[model samples]
Target: MDQVVTQKPHELLAETLSTKMAAVNTLIQTRMASEHAPRIPEVTAHLVNAGGKRLRPMLTLAAAKLCGYAGEDDVKLAATVEFIHTATLLHDDVVDESGQRRGRPTANLLWDNKSSVLVGDYLFSRSFQLMVETGSLQVLDILANASATIAEGEVLQMTAASDLKTDESIYLQVVRGKTAALFSAATQVGGVIAEASDTQVQALYDYGDALGIAFQIADDLLDYQGDAKTTGKNVGDDFRERKLTLPVIKAVAQATDEERAFWTRTIEKGRQEDGDLEQALALMAKYQTLEATRADALVWAAKAKDALNVLPETAIRTMLVDLADYVVARLH
Candidate 1:
């Protein structure tokens, strides 16, 4: 119901979140600063120092604390989430050939793709080590599966690119794989570590999955609709890349034969030029791709809220729901 993007004076809970997330931060710095292979410290620090929201780790810590967890395991678990997220970002930049991240030159751009890839692997290994320290076999099992799902999702996305045949189903699967799997595991693992019951754990898992999906869909929507300056990325980056995102996928399904031909030639065949972006945006508008994408994001957000019905009501729980809403609200 509430918009996520429009931040009111009293709305942001970052201050409330920082206290709980402090341990998550500590875990990240200590684990990521390991002295191994010499190059590890240097390459890894590039990513570790670049400040992102740390949302994934904060979710883990907040979920654990809300569920009455008074133990130290939350810190390690939170760190694990950050490691997985950072690793994914490193690999994603490399895969996308992206030059910028968080308004700075990406690790791959600053160093080399090879270093980014290898450092990503190092983080992945350290993530597992953090999991081991948690001593929860279920935690390990959940995260191990998440890791596999994330890798599979990345490969799926790589193949899905530049193909106009990509449908909503395929696109959703890719987003779920590449994005939602880790979110699901991060929150669910927090519940598991807190010894929450199966029902609660399942609720958190669904919440994270739906939240991740909604968050990603919102991002795709912003590619066309967002302010490039605020988003810290180029407008129509997806379009210029000719990537088959949700908006493009929906547009293809609704296109006429002539429009379909244009899509096939320009997006699929690929040779993005000056006016290609304008043509792509016009096509998307003709087919209402932005609206369709927004609807999909709303559907997932509703699903995320529905999953929260199973969670016991608490300030943290309410904030998590609010946070989910805030994600989509940014698009408005």
Candidate 2:
């Protein structure tokens, strides 16, 4: 008997959208190339070829198809979305001083930071070029605003990540800026290109926003309890990096004076000692903050699913709803 393989939601979406994704990949390669600067392609390819889910670009394609689009502009916008996402990863790795990404060495590590930053800027320019080719002022406006929001979020994180006063509201703002902005824009642009009704476009935006929030919250939660090999990150990396993730922020909110001192010394003062990770885990366990964070993620995932009620029921829509669940399901 043949063995049956169970496909994940993203895998299913990829299979369904394989042809469009191929075009997007081709465009990405053609645009990433630079005649004068060979290093640009090298650095860009290093990160681009790395095993990523391609979820953001896929969202664009899916939204376009869902809105009954027949034109080729969806492909261009899909490629644009991907370029923007890849550029952000390159810059983010440098900002975080990260050694690994997507279970591989980061581009900044393989090449120099200068190479990474310059190549990232090159990709951003390429993304704009692709978007301009679409000739839609609305699409350009959406993506441009998303780019600005991403930068603003990064700057906010720089100031807020180590600060003890970073609360849930501030954290939500950062998540929306750094993560959800692109997601919502990707979907929103898809609808815009298809000339979808204003209501449908808003629905797509809402779905993407909630899904992105769920995705990030799940990622932050995983940093505390996930398998390092699976997640491509060591457990407690967020704690070690002094990032004020949702779980840590929740724990800080409920901390006693002694626990507050621990957060102050480790996160605020950057004086993480040996066994501190264990103590941090113990504190989170004591407060059940991880569980609380997981609950929040689930809530967002639910909202993402609910947002799809406005769209027509189809396989793509179902997959998108399932994709939202799968992001948080990693916790299980």
Candidate 3:
């Protein structure tokens, strides 16, 4: 009989950080509540309970503890980070017209798009309230800037997505804006609230920035390679939606005129038909873009691990290092 692996490092991190995470969870529940509008909590609860990894908020809490913080503000910051993330998900579903997330019906599918948008706005307001309680001007500035960057990234994607002209630089800008901005903010604010040294704070920011890049790249790669049951997403979902993620971007860069026409019709003109997805996958495989994209993700993961060298070593730090590895490990 084969022996079972008891837990992963993140599971252990969660166990070690259980007490603080409980406080963060309580704060999230309390803040997500709305006195006048019952619909706010209803929609919020649906998504909040959807079993995400809570990795962004966990980054905030882990950074604070790693920096030797013992105050209550880390909990508030963690909850605030979660609110910001949840708000983005709600808004993203509306934008994507997505029907499912975390293997369940998205809030927009269950409720009207207007309700999802309004509740997402309410959560953003709640996040601001929590940030003000932290009372750090720098922290507020970081989060505020991250929020703006996220919106900008989404808008950029709207214009650039499906356009073969979008190079890797534009793709990276969108990734940094949509994903890494919040991640960097989460870790940076944790160090700020802890009064960590400038070098340590910068190190945390770098770690998160690289980790977020790796994570999003892995996700994009998985769209072509992953099982729908495991990924909780339909394979070819990006293809069907005509979103030009990294692997497709690489394939596009090397396309023949014949291949380019296929992309133009399906992605640019949105006239997808039977075998389009299979043909698209064939182009990616022919270009070896999926392998190239995986290599890129591993590079960012390595960068994240390297960034951690600036911080003092601790159990939490080790777990964070492992967490970075695990983010890309999903690709294998």
Candidate 4:
């Protein structure tokens, strides 16, 4: 027999699941439309049309496939996950007052904040409708809790954003709420919908939870380290916004008194000046916080890979392990 070579994890996942993803796209379009308020669809479409990796939805599909699911509800669940994710992005851009997303103007910029917020609410409602269609109370409970947890994470982040007293434990909680909740829910629902064993469901949840933390950490590190073209974001965007991500948190923990004042002025007080970014980078380098942050990301990525051990060995599992590796590989 001729050997079959698998492509990269994401690409292979996309190819393997292309047919289902197409169904998901169709469902997204059909559900997002609003005849009464056409502007709703217009605002929703702007962000939805903008290119995203759709990793959450793909995780749902991959989990279902890996667990030997043979039904169509995975499509609805995947769409539900994407809707939840898109609604968050729309709301996040409004909350952040951001103008750019996925290398294009945010919906709030093109339309208005009011439009963005209302449309985001609409999508949230639509996601619930789709979730209901799955006819699984466990799936509903998981996704609903994830929605609340995501909101809690964002709220916690707002409170913790510039507080110098915020520590790694709080930071981890914030990361889990904001990023990992939906990831774990996505995978967990996939397994639940597939009727997978309890152990497999737990394994999927563990994998997603760890992968999300690592992914967010790498993203935070890249804000200080990545090029604009590569990261789809300008360097120091986090610093400019006064957001206290992991790298900044690590630097703050080790700051000298003078450096603490500098962080206070620049981060807490939003008093950044011409050389503030350079100085921030200098301090992070001095404390090796960026490297420390990368190490943390690697650890989480390893946990995600380890979580896959209980599952049956298959191509999807290999891809998932590679996906975890790729998340940390961003530091390279």
Best by lDDT: 2
Q: How accurate is candidate 3 locally (lDDT)?
A: 0.93
- Order of candidate numbers by lDDT, starting with the best: 2, 3, 4, 1
Query: How do the residues 73-172 of candidate 4 rate in per-residue lDDT, one tens digit apiece?
Result: 9999999999999999989999999999989999999999998899999999999999999899999999999999999999999999889999999999
lDDT measured at residue 101 in model 1 versus the true structure, 0 to 100: 83
Error of 1 at 270 (Å): 0.8
Write the number of the candidate with greater TM-score, choosing between 1 and 2. Answer: 2
Weakest 10 consecutive residues, lDDT, candidate 4?
1-10
Model 3, runs deviating above 4 Å: 1-5
Residue-pair clashes per prediction, in order, are 4, 0, 0, 0
- Give the TM-score comparing model 3 with the true structure, all chains together: 0.98
lDDT of 2 by residue, 106-127 (tens): 9989888998888889989999
Error of 3 at 175 (Å): 0.7
Please, what is the TM-score per model? 0.94, 0.98, 0.98, 0.97
| Candidate 4 displacement at residue 331 in angstroms | 1.1
